[model samples]
Target: MKPFYIDYPQEKIAEHQHAYRCLHCKIPTTIIFGLLENHAKDCAYRIHQGRWTQLEASLKPIQKHFDEPHIDEVD
Candidate 1:
């Protein structure tokens, strides 16, 4: 897991020039501190990330044995 959830899209806070927050959840960056749980449960970023992780886990290739012979394709 990432130490921080900084990858989510951010929008500048209107009142503070330098302050930013999550675009979907509107939670301040300082408050979120990179933890996904800090974002709202229905946050768009969180929802997309959940599905992305699941897809990646399911798509992982199985490990092959070292003893397996290599086959070369004919030219």
Candidate 2:
């Protein structure tokens, strides 16, 4: 999926508070070194951000290699 980037301005809200906004949904969020990703997960416009299919497609080749059996040494 394409990355959903949040806007974090250089200025702080108060002292330790930082304001964040979703570029896709235009929703305001306040956080302090917290999980900014949670906003995107609950955002209504998350679907417009990107699709998980893109990520799956990119990982298919890597996943295929990992699926192959490997010989392990026993001591």
Candidate 3:
């Protein structure tokens, strides 16, 4: 089976979607499921209808798993 990363169709999403800036990382990112919707339940996000929100508000913790180091050993 393809890994989640492999399964995720980034090219399609990238061509048409906008991403919000991460509150903690200050990097452009999407509001991930479960993390924003559940785990960080108290957090808030400014979901603008027209365009991506600027890094004006220190709103919420968004997913950033791609930047994290792997648990397994790396060569």
Candidate 4:
């Protein structure tokens, strides 16, 4: 998966409930699907700091890989 950013609360980071853990402190962080302006409230990883916006493209490629052909093969 591409590296998407999330602005999680510092307190939540302490609990570590979220799956994505902070790289620096190893604490749980939030996941932001898209880009945004301004730092989120109480977030340890603020986009304003310099964290590059990242995201995984559409899942179409993965789905197509697993999808089976509908038409019958020639005999």
User: What is the full ranking by TM-score, best candidate first?
Assistant: 1, 2, 4, 3
Give lDDT tens digits, candidate 1, residues 1-75. Answer: 455667999999999989999999999999888888888899999888878777887898988778655687354
* Candidate 3, 1-75: lDDT as tens digits: 111211111222344455444453233345443133221333233233111223433354675667666779595
The C-alpha lDDT values of all candidates are: 0.86, 0.46, 0.33, 0.42
Task: Kindly report which residue pairs in candidate 4 clash with one another.
Answer: none
Worst 10 residues of 2 by lDDT: 4-13
Report the Cα RMSD per candidate. 5.9, 6.4, 17.1, 9.6
Best by TM-score: 1
The residue pairs found clashing in candidate 3 are none
- In candidate 2, stretches whose alpha carbon ends up further than 4 angstroms from where it belongs are 1-18, 31-45, 52-59, 62-75
Give candidate 1's TM-score. Answer: 0.67
Clashes of each: 2, 0, 0, 0
Per-residue lDDT value at 15 in model 4? 41
Candidate 1 residue-wise lDDT at 53: 75
Cα deviation of 24 in candidate 2 (Å)? 3.7
Give a tens-digit lDDT track for model 4, residues 1-75.
334434443343444454554443444433333323233444445533344333224433554455665578563
How displaced is residue 3 in candidate 1, in Å?
3.4
Rank ordering of all candidates by lDDT, starting from the highest: 1, 2, 4, 3
